[model samples]
Target: MRFFNTEGPNRADDHYSLPPLSRWDLDAILTLIEQKKYFLLHAPRQTGKTTCLLALMDYLNREGRYRAVYANLEGAQAYRENVDAAMAVIVTDIAASARVWLGDTDAPVLAREVLATTPHGSALSLFLAHWCQRIPQPMVLLLDEVDALVGDTLISLLRQLRAGYPQRPDAFPQALILCGVRDLRDYRIHASSEQAPITGGSAFNIKAKSLRLGDFDAEEVATLLHEHTAETGQAFTPEALARVWELTQGQPWLVNALAYEACFEQPEGRDRAQPIGVDLIDRAKETLILNRVTHLDQLTHKLREPRVRRIIEPMLGGTALGEAFEEDREYLVDLGLLRRDGAGGLVIANPIYREVLPRALASGPQDSLPQISPTWLNPDGSLNPDRLLDAFLAFWRQHGEPLLASAPYHEIAPHLVLMAFLHRVINGGGRLERAYAIGRGRMDLCLRDGAVTLGLALKVWRDGRPDPLTEGLTQLDAYLAGLGLDRGWLVIFDRRARQPPIEARTSSHETLSPAGRCIQVVRA
Candidate 1:
């Protein structure tokens, strides 16, 4: 039976997948290869880069024009700065791939001998030179995870590839495709022998173009889900299909993971006759976020890097990004953590990431809180918005300061702490949706539980800024109108240097918005 694949490269025979080559401009890529131009293929991890490269290799070999091989260079990462050791592993892997995919044993045999005799720095170029010379057809090499090797190993590989570019067809591969999570221009390698960092562009100046493998389009996403319905007769409701696309924004791993969880992992969904619904998809999204699965966890880990933090901090704070933040913004876009919205403003890459970022940031603060009763939940377990507000006020008065200190993104600590408390309130029975963006000056949240839906707008009062109450109320009015609720909360966190203590200043007042929606204004 075919299933959604979340692991390595997807095999069409075993996994439900979109056509790999369909995600790229195949004509352009083929033109590059035909011209013998070395180029790059890059995308975030688990986005089908390997699958596409393997498909291209197969297509090239079947055309009877080139001897094509795809090799994963990740194995060389273990050797780190040991260039010679790394080159040996890389050469061996390339040979193994050639034998498996191209039925070429002679190339590996020759490569092993050549590598044995070559020096550390020039070993890769020498081995490739010998192997290509022996091949019957012009060689097309696809090196996957090319950026996985760090330090001297990475510099050596790129430099060697560049050095061999002048000798083509007969002495070196006719066309080389390097694949990794980021473009070559973004790579910063610190070689032990060099005093300064070497940019990948400097090391590999021969790159013709960098082609990115995009996520599935809406039509492609529908086609993948339909495969399951066609096979098992267990259909996804139209709403479920739309929800999946909205949540994932066509991110490959997220689309597959959410579907797999909803249709395969959930016990209720195991009955083949049952249709998958929007609620089930929502549950699956929550499950993935709460578990911090490998893919999402890997992204969260990047938040610690200073470059990553610079972009993320301003984003969460809703402040304007400075000119200096441009490079970092581009870097995050390449990593698939952020993307340009239609208006060209920066936003989280997708809804799932938008949800994951704050939740992951709040995890530390959430862990430090003391056990408290779900005071806002009614006897029948329905959420009471007014009671919830009262409970939050009490919680903030007593414990909010310490929890804020515990948050990882200090610029948005108050927001994170509030979210952590609200998450605890709605843990089992409800869902929370967050929306924030660069220069928005506020964060909007919507909480849903059964028939109760609450809208909230959060603003921070920073130095030299007036109290944001009037603006916040206007925003909350618009937010409540969108949520179809007549009442909502506008939380203004006072973050100025000489503010009174939180316990003494935190208070709430009720007011009417310009739209006349009842607004509960909370000052913390």
Candidate 2:
């Protein structure tokens, strides 16, 4: 009866689950609690932080060493417009959770009494002070989705907790853990009491540490899948496991989603008894991405956020503004969109995410448009860039005007359209690596056709600038230097210099520099 859990917390009986506490770094967390230290627990959405905290709460409460409660403040989202209303909901939710777990409904009454008596600016701190005074054992509070509260409400919560820090073990919660997608340090909150910026370090100043719950390791992922094999006598071939890891990079939701699709959704022919293999995983990836399921859709919805766009645009352009790069880079990493690359800097988190995102964000035409023929691909499994780009240029001349007319992604339409065209051709055959960045001069794309590696560098020009041979040659030289490539192709999207209708668009290849390296220029 066990199944993959794509939704909320996994149950031992209903879902194939990991050993309680086995999936998290619980020892470190417990050490913080024992030392009376406040800390952070964060990871991308649905990566099991809430589940881990709930389990930890149970362990602590059942041990009878402390009173622990896990409370989600997300319900306070509605109070975003009214600070007083938001505070009331927060206090009530905390009280309700405490009542259920601590056998203390009166907790709220005492908290409200404290708030009524305390000074206007410090009500929450005083309320927590009162509640802590009445509780018998030391308390461990796990605040989930604390980042969901915006502006002042967030500041109040952090400041209140900070104010109550000195009363640990008596009148305050010992071992407070704040959980959200962002670390506490990223919180930018300002309050009426202080005109200056309130760094999280100052507001939640007592935090002894910030601990991010990481995704499962590859071995752990295999072990999770293996449990199903043990129970149902079905097996996952080694190739399948590798495919899953390559695609998901051990992301929890993705891991579960791939397995769910392969085992349950794949056609029976492909889901045969011969241990599930790489082909099945590939098929699952294609089907899931093409279908645009709720989980994938929700994650991409973040693309509309300005912060997300700021980070993503540079990646699409293959260059990033150096200033403040680290902070935004860390934010994207925490979002699970990018991961550290030992030598290559930061790369997209995984192949599946890389493949899914562009398509997911591509406008309506890309999704609903007619499929391009595979005629451009050679029988030797090679893509003739000269032919492909030329053919695409012709197609663009004919339909690009119409497509770009209604395209909402006007600034990046050229890139998306080309990517979509390439994706259609390489849909089932090869992998295309997309590297673009906001304000970065060029978009670098690497096409891997088994043994052949082709690099395409695209530069965008706004005005009718003269031929960019000198600048383009220099940039290409630097890019080729890093890529260890000798020759490559460059496509320039000159906003003011489109080919004269039907008669002028053409592709030309020529040698550049004393080295006489080949570079193709496709003017469209």
Best by TM-score: 1
Best-fitting candidate, scored by lDDT = 1
Give a tens-digit lDDT track for model 1, residues 13-69.
Answer: 999988888888889988888899998888998899999999999899899899899
lDDT score for residue 423 of model 2: 66
lDDT of 2 by residue, 377-440 (tens): 6787677766676677767767665555444356666677767666676665776776654445
Shift of residue 455 alpha carbon in model 2, Å: 7.9
Q: What are the per-model C-alpha RMSD values against the true structure?
A: 1.8, 5.1
> Any idea what lDDT model 2 has?
0.73
- Each model's TM-score, in the order given? 0.97, 0.80
Model 1, clash count?
Answer: 0
User: Which residues of candidate 2, in runs, are more than 4 Å off?
Assistant: 102-127, 190-201, 269-274, 324-326, 364-390, 401-412, 423-505, 508-521
